[model samples]
Target: MAFHEMLAPDYIFESSWEVCNKVGGIYTVLSTRVRTLLNLFKKDKIFFIGPFLHKKESNIEFIESETILDSWRKYANEQEGLKVRVGYWNIPGKPITILVDFLPFYEEKDIIYFQMWEKYHIDSTVAYGDYDDSCMFAYATSKVIESLYHFLQLQGKKVIAHLNEWMLGMAVLYIHKYLPTVATLFTTHATSIGRSICANNKPLYGQLSNYNGDQMASELNIKGKHTLEKLAAFYANCFTTVSEITGKECTQLLEKKPDIIIPNGFDSDFVPKGKMFETKKVKARSVLINVIQKLIGLSIPENAFLLATAGRYEYKNKGIDVFIETIYRLKKTYFDRPIIAFVLVPACLQGARADLKERLENAVSSQFPLPRPFITHELVGPLCNDPICEYLYYLNFTNEDDSQVKIIFVPSYLNGEDGIFNMVYYDLLIGMDLTVFPSYYEPWGYTPLESIAFHIPTITTNLTGFGIWAKSKGAKSDTLDLGVAVVERTDDNYFETAEAIKNIIVKYITKYDSSQILNIQRTSCALSKKAFWSHFIKYYLQAYDVALRKL
Candidate 1:
């Protein structure tokens, strides 16, 4: 399709911390939604820019080929003082991508910070840790955009710079200031100060209305990121967030209302079909059971209920604390069926547990449980520092021969070679009967959506973006018959939410009606199909239109 005939911007340039790097949920959003975006524009029109972290080596997800813009690449490399790898992302859409080496920017980042402070009043005086590196990357990405824009002579074209997260907030400000013709869409997945508040164990929901973002940032020592996010949200041609919940967060915390609310959509291709699906599911189950039996030294029955809660290890913010409480509450109940709940949250792991590896190697269930039997891998840090393991220790899980519930904390990433489990996240995800993501401060609950996508019923709280979307679509907010149960989570309703989850699981387990369960699973798959990028891509197009018109 010709540029004039198409409804999309002439070129769509998107930058994220997770473009090629699989850091978090943002990777899921961009990588999965590429196919849908490509349908609107040609492969070259939609450009994704990210950091080059693979040390000049070829990344499995990136295919570096001869440049379509070789002249510009050469000029930018030598003349424009930029370093980038021109490539196509090896994903479903195989879209064009540019992974930039931003390390050189570190030397000039202080000067760049001064410029930002002068131009946008972004405070970076007290920034620490990953702040400098991320800011340098964002600034470098913007410079890359600027150089490419001038080189391509895309001055009068309807171009968009869709920058994601606070990490890319600098890019938004830079494009908005330097390239006025190109519209900028800044999306804050979660406000920095808001997340900091929750991560610091402060009561966010109840005190949100009374809280000032600047004051909280000062109190929490996150003024640099918070200020950049706030100003970016204010000055961008269009500000977008992932969900209604996160949009409200931006309004309250960042003090700028989002122009569009685009929910993250799933890729249907990730799911297998027919015999392949069943085969993977069976293998997943067998692996899960084998790991559990080996770790706990007990024969797990075929009817074991495999429940899990997997994501970043934010014990309170991700409601991992609540998940543990739910398990604790459920264990007190007298359910006849055995429960195998796995905590798949990756952390700073030393490696797979030596004792567990020995048991698995022998392919035999232990006659007795080993020490610290609840975890698959040992942590690099002390047990007291880890909220999950510390809390599990407090709960005193025996993992005995006749225990009702066996909790295994796999504190390592499931990349098909996590020493134990030996399967990737989705492979293990498929075998689960139920999943929970009762997040206290989730921008978008991709874990729960992924669970439902794989036909496993999930229980997520209304606080999440996905949970609110599920509620709006009328997915039995607190029932299992429809596959997803959105539990009502509140600041003070910690016990209530745990009780609700415990009740839901108990009922589902006791129902023992295979036909109804199968119906729920089918309904889950059907619901996920509705949330495919093909359906959700329209909202992105709407955001693009909003940004283009603003210019």
Candidate 2:
């Protein structure tokens, strides 16, 4: 049969821990793809299943709709004794969502685990921490799916339960056993062993081809999670991953070659256009400058370059160490222009600094150096314990008089109430002159894509899926001329990566004229257009076809 001429699902039920929770990159994957799904199927035909902690907690992302799926909601609750709330996810698509309360399933966790082991050979007895919660949620989600399938009287109808990550793996297993008619697709954003190897400071890319996934999982003490992820990949009708890099990891670490590669795509509706874009950029730059000057008690130059590296505070994995190293190198080698770099990585932090808050409010500048001068927020523990803070102190990248490259650590989530900028991340991202994400271990980088979407040229490593995609589309070197610099980053090239980034920044700040810089920004914006959901949604259609064909 031709690939394009395969069966399509009548009802699509997608589940993720980050459906409306907004935890990490997975949230970006599911939320952004909603509109495309809605365009393919009617709003009522698409359903999103997520874990429901509380109404108060999820009120921001979910709007309870008492009318939609009213019959199945009641049936799942009364007959199945399941707790579920049907609603609409508060995104652009506003698709139907069912947030299932999984707390009740914890009481029968043993039976659930036993059934999983007996049927699918998934061992959950050694699982700890969030495993129980995730499994219970998966069990609840499966019950919801089964109840809905029977209640709707669609026994043989084409239904797909697409689950994301190992957290929702049990849902695939449950559907495989109980609702065998439902086609299942499982996508692992990053395998447990691959992440563990990187976290342990081991060389992942250099030695990836020779590693045994099960052995490495035991060594890393992640056997339970790895087993579940492996089982899901093995049992699902179609197992998939986010990017080509992650597909290789799945093949080596999980021992299962993916049936398809569904790279993540975004909706560009959030990006401002024309004058609005310029206005937003100006406002963001103003806000960023004000915050930095207040925190550092120094008047930054008018032509200072505002650079940033933002994401989760994975010091080594996200290449935060390399970012700091590049800044230090820039300071030591080239001080021709003033550069202010923001490490917008959220860490375990206390609230905003009291003294800094007072200084900002009172418009006072301290002549003496403040404790942890480069950091905006107070650390929860001793400053020496945090890797980034410790490294900054060791390198003396303190925003003192002699240092031309000033670094500010914004160690709080930018959710419009971080007590510092009080602005969301995107509101601040537009202000950046250049963004860098030299990730040592990124499955699919959203930060660099976001930076380019804002018309800001960015530098990322070739290890990332997005970087590889950019390279395929003519990103040749670590220079602003390409708009997106896909720096060659192997496991052993830490210092080399830092040097390459330093040179890129030096070239951009010194050599590029205003018109040239504007052209680079235009190139970045053009590259972002190629990654929109409209261009990338066909890969998802292909994945669905693969799953249905397998069924």
Candidate 3:
């Protein structure tokens, strides 16, 4: 490979805090991409590095295995004093994954931070909470990379180290300093300061260009993470983001325009084939309807519409605030059938509601609502001060017999054993007639993409990355006709955004009959096919090319 030509990577080391760990949207993004990545790169050459927590978690979730890199593993353990495990990740491709036990690095954190500050100018003193743990993991990942690079003799080869998020920012800086031969690509899913501003209820979109990221980070007390991310972006050979929306965010907040935009692509395998999809839909809808019926003690008709809003519990950021209000508006408007909205957000919880579980198990039906009919699980503290729960209370959702509109708060991860709805999130998602993620500050918005993949027409605002991409791909402006409704949203137009989403649903249900509805669902599935990694992997290849060319 020469400096004049675009270089192809012979090996790629993809590192993330959520490589095997199922945490957030990054997990979904990476796990789904392994198969497609393997198609372009050589087999067994792409390695994913993640943090190793404990023996039990490793044993349960990982399959420890032998690979050609065994020599490097041995060297890492004996010379580097690093606890590491080489295994196959339990996801789709089961890609070769190395989980480093980063706990040992805590003893040397101070020295490592000092070294980082000395070399890369990263500030670690102001870091708090998960900062130290993430940095330690990142440092350990860099060490693992160093050991593997020498052992594999990849010095002259096109070796690319792809690091994701600020959690792995240190790895980017470390690789650049220690292994200059290895091209580093650092992708920030979202700018730390941008997310912090939104999480703090500040108007991000309305005054984005005017806001100084450094100043906001200082005000938000996230300078450590912010500076780490900013410098990492500046240091990396290639800095990329998930979408153009986040690309602009990275430019504005991190002050470094991304080298490329690697839009998130879904795996077709997640969606069941032909009859399997319908079967899963039947099972999911059955469980969903049964749970709501048992809790609300109402006969939820077989054809009643099932709506959902699921994601991280960023109430204002994810537009859960607007969603709750939309449900109120939807309720105020007349609908001929029963409409039930499930808020599938994981939050602080004790356990499943014992009463609801018993009722679901017994197949009990009642004409009266339970004490806490609005929520399926019991929150940690007394009826609690949860925003969603409180807002529903504020709206007075009675789930009454004649109300025809009901909202249920499922404050648990729907991972097959939430004790109430024992189905996984996807299995449950396939059942939804419509999904809404009116996110105010969504960077990439995977929920809507997931919903559309499941062939469920979804409503999201233009403020989201997926929404922007969908619009560019000719997603209808104010209709569910294209399977996605990208509603207009701004910092101040909360009510308008909510009404727009509600109106899409209302119009969708009122205008289309059974056949037209099925066509729209199929159209959504087809649209999602355009976002499959098979199609979007070209962008990543471009990133890889650019990264190696810089070398």
Candidate 4:
């Protein structure tokens, strides 16, 4: 039995998007790891404390956590910078305590967005030059931690605050000064500055010589937050990054060295636990038809080859342009099928969205078959309209024929609405012949890993943190002949991408034998099993054990 299972603490407090809120990979970490973490500890011992948007309703009752309130009333009266409300509300089905603030920053006359949708308008800079809603988000997080610590102290429970990312890193720093007994654990999944420069193909440091250096510097100045990151790195009792490559980059690029490398893993159990590549032939075909039918309704070819690319909206960084160019060139030259590439890429579509759309369309010449000309299709058709309906409408629309060359560009935020988001993508992978992720910078890609898990051979670049690890572990790459191809981003030719796509499409169209396809599927399952949960969850419990021992 694990040491955590033995020690079974009185309480475990975790904060991230996944628990009650979810953003990206961090959400996965919180949801997957925290559940297992709770198993090691007691269920009642864990409390996930984070700011709840007042509009977002929860089943937990808002009983005045008099302990937290009393502690905060005293602390707030004493400190000036820490002037904030600290109270608790019970989340239903569980004794979940939510730490919230009703300070000047959090004061709202009327909450505009009750639903926790990623609102881009709120992301933009205000005319008054005030900070974005993210600042309030950061401030509220600090207050939450403060409130939780106070509650813990009043109960005489020793507390360990494990913070994920730089925003929470700041909160840890704030609370540590006041609470000496607190053990702080900080994890930087990816630094914003490192990611920005890497994605833009600029030097990680130093100005771009040809452009406005000052303006560029101002836009890319992650130094202020990173200083806090570095301090957390040096000061925190424990620090970890998601991948080994990212760990090195944190030290070398961001100057915030990580003490440990907790390479990210998926909750294998959450994904359909089955033979990874069992193609329910009829079910697979039906799913394929359902995906293609929607595109055909949009005038795309029913038999068009579907090669998908889905991720967050950083198009340039996610290598959407590269994926588009390859598809466009292939559609123009090779197989004369009507190509429909669906883009489920998400961005804050408030300002530059039109620009992003225009850029994507312009990149792919309008001389193709459809009125749009470019193959890139949105899961949610346009920027306007209710996204839920947009997602549902597409999901509900289906075609009679299943086979088509469809590429779905998925934006990151899927609220489990329209059931189609994750389901459709999975269908595309199992039914479609190929998936490509030509990322220039990925902290740790779940897409290609997911693709392989689904029994679809994927083309991933060397630049991705996962790809690097795969190469080290002898993950295969073929000249368009086998399952799972790894192409080096820096070394591979631009034409090589098109050539590879053509070869794969031709193979599928001409000679994808059942045995060969099944072999690929089985390979995917083998890979998935190799990276199972039992192998990794212990690391989290162990890391905490080490951290507490240090304390």
Candidate 5:
């Protein structure tokens, strides 16, 4: 079917945030689908509803008419109105309108806490409830839906409320009790239990830390999760997840399977593709190379291999520590032939920064330490002095432009400054020899999938969404294959990650001639075409069918 042929009924997806206010992969999933969604559902049929937390202008106005608002306010006041006026307003976008609710959290500031803990790219020493936060969260969820319900009632349009993840799933359960025929569709991008277990193999809090399967199933109210998800699985009109791997995980973990697997795709309008690269921005390329030199304080030879890696901070989970260690290991073997390894993973907290600093220090001292003066300045001087070092310094060190290869950490919850950093990352992506992401807990990573779409080779582990999807398409090997190199995530030390990076560097930057580079690019583009728009959109159509049949 043509891209325009797929249609999903008036689909209204609600989450804590979306692209304009992204904090995780969820934002990437929503934003990348904008073009495809517009083509599928057309205008008005698709709407994204989230809390209004930033510098957003609210134009669509509605008076709070529901008694539920009064009930929410009374409850809020009783709990001291923890969240600051979050009212709802509609923002116009092509193919869909975004309805944002901001009244419940009008004057509050605890968003920093949630953003730091759940969405912030940095690590923190602070605990989750250093302040009273639950009431406010419950309030935000309730009020947003309460406000959204009245707004949709005003529009007189029937909606299939598509709630993503557990927080929004809670809202769906509450909303469904009142409006049973609303045709709700619940999607668990990743189950809470599954993610928490994946992240640390323990419960999020110590309260349920010791509980085994049955005890955990009962103690922290697993029934509540099972109840919500099962209701969605068996009771809701339809259910979906971002990828088939994640969908399967949700079913097995939640004990309730989704009806469809809506794998994510890139927003071709934003990310560069095959023909897009042929129209390269030469100035953008030069600006990036300059930035790289400034960052490392070493000028690199023009022919020196440049490899890049980046993602939100989940350093261990995203396999960044392994990436760094790999570079350290490879540098030992290829010291004579310099290669610039650009690290671009974000760190969420001061603690995470210190931790990364310590790791980098250990790597430097063990492998690349200077002969004289232990101080940071003294050590970097020799690195800046060599003629080959002169090339490295200018190209990798002095080039502060993010487009070039340099270890650049982009922070979480991108706002004014960070948004520019994100754009730079996109620009830098074009110049990369390869991009590596070996995530241990990614439900469906957008990075590897996006890298291929951009015609850049990538490395993703089986633990990621795209890796499993690639395997589905017959991709194999621990080396450079399938336009992606799949590194198995195991108890085996960091050597596997290091080996994969070394192979990619050898295949793309070190060993390959222009003809070989062109072949890799062609393979990447072909793989992208396989994922392009067909496979994912068909799942959406199937979901619509399931939803309509149930309705």
Candidate 6:
């Protein structure tokens, strides 16, 4: 069958734990894709369902809309005792949203789990932590969908309930059992087994083909979550993944092949351009330099290169180890300019350091180093326990008087209120001369894409989906000539990966001229254009088509 001939959904409903909640990369996927979806479907035809929390305590990303779905809202409340708030997401799309209050469903948790086991074989009896909360919310979302389908009296209209990640996979099973006519699509951003294996220091990519997912899940004590995910993938009308790399992981780890690959894409509407971009970059650099100077008590060189690596604090999975190794190697090389690297990954921080705050407020520049000179915030635990800090201490890159390479750990979320920089992540990201994310287990790296979106060249390993995509489009690994360096990496090639990154940084600092650097920056921006949602939304349409056809 021709791809274009597939049926299109009249009403599309997307459910996720990250919806209206900025937790991780899946939030980026759903929020960024909204504008494109809004353009295709009517504003009322699209709905994003998420768990509702108290408005005062939650960082709510939704604006309540009482009039939009008033009729269905009343019907659901009166008939099914379903409590939901209709709203518009405060994003580029401003699409209609339904935040369901799942607290009422807590009493029915055991019954819901039993039904799940009987209908779909999802075992949640041994589930703990986020299992109960996510399942309750998913159950609430399913009720909301059923109410809407009935209230609207649309028995035959094409509808899609797309659930993202394992947290929301219960909704797919719910729809499969109750509303069989509603086409269901489940997208597992990353399999539980795959991530667990990586976190446990197991060789995932190297031994992927040989490993039995169920055996690994049982061994890792993640069988419950893995079973739920596996069943969702098996039962969904169309099972999709965010990247080709994750597609392979899903096939092996979940025991199911993805119906289609819907790669994550960036929306460039948030990025600044022209003189505005330059102005933001200047402000960002000033903020970064000021904070570092206050903490380390030394004014860095004017031409010092600013670099960073930011994401969830997954040391090995995100390649913080290799990043530190590369920085250590770069310190021993003969480079004239100083390099200041920021490890922007959030960790357990006890607010900003009192001494650092006092220095920033007083604008004092003391010659003596602070207690922990390289770390910006006071850790909640012993400083010796942090892998990145411990590794830096082991390597002796402690921002000493004679050290050319300075590493500062900003272990707080950059939400314009990190006390020191007082700048959001994107604000600080634009000031970077380069970014490095040589990840060992990245599905679709958003940091490198965000770097290139800001027109900063980056170094990432081919193990990442973005790196492979960039290489297929003629990206070079050893040079910043093509904007992104795609380093070849494997389970056993840790030192080689580190050495490759070190060589690239050395080349950029020693060989590239000012004009050449400008060219690389421009090339990075051009490559980012290829990843815009305008170009990648077709893959999602394909997935939607497959789901509808399955109905």
lDDT of 4 at 190: 79
Segments of candidate 5 deviating more than 4 angstroms: 1-16, 54-99, 102-158, 201-235, 272-285, 335-337, 349-423, 491-494
State how far residue 61 of model 6 sits from its true place (Å). 1.5
Instruction: State the lDDT of candidate 3 residue by residue for 507-535, as single tens digits.
Output: 99888999999899989988999988888
TM-score of each: 0.97, 0.97, 0.97, 0.70, 0.69, 0.97
TM-score of 1: 0.97
Residue 385 CA error for candidate 5 (Å)?
Answer: 31
TM-score of predicted model 3? 0.97
TM-score of 6: 0.97
Segments of candidate 2 deviating more than 4 angstroms: 1-4, 55-58, 363-369
Per-residue lDDT of candidate 1, residues 1-551 (tens digit): 23344356889899998988887899999999988888878888889998999563767878887755678888999998898888888899898999899999989977998999898788899677778888999999999999989988998798999999999988888888888888998888888998899999889888888999999999989999889889888888889999998887888888888999988998978888999999999999998998887777778888889999999988899999899999988878786779989888999989988888888888764777777778889899887788888898898876767678878888999887888888889998999999988899998989988998999999999999998888877876558777789998888899999999999998888864998999999988888888898888878888888888787
Error of 4 at 472 (Å): 3.5
* RMSD of candidate 1 to true structure, Å: 2.0
Clashing pairs in 3: none
Could you give candidate 6's per-residue lDDT for residues 1-551 as a string of tens digits? 45458678899989998888887898889899999888888888899998788653344588987798998888888889998888888889788889888999999988988888887776686566788888889889988998888888768899999998888878888899889989999998888889989999999998999999988988888777888899889999999987788889998888899999888999988899889999999999888888888777787776889898999999999999999898888888866777999999999988988899999899887777787899998888898898988998899877887778889889999988988888889999999999999898888988899999999999998989899889988898788788999999998899999999989998888888999999999999999999999899888888888888887
TM-score comparison, 1 vs 6, better candidate: 6
List candidate 6 segments past 4 Å from native: 1-4, 55-60
Q: Judge candidate 4 at residue 243 and give its lDDT.
A: 77
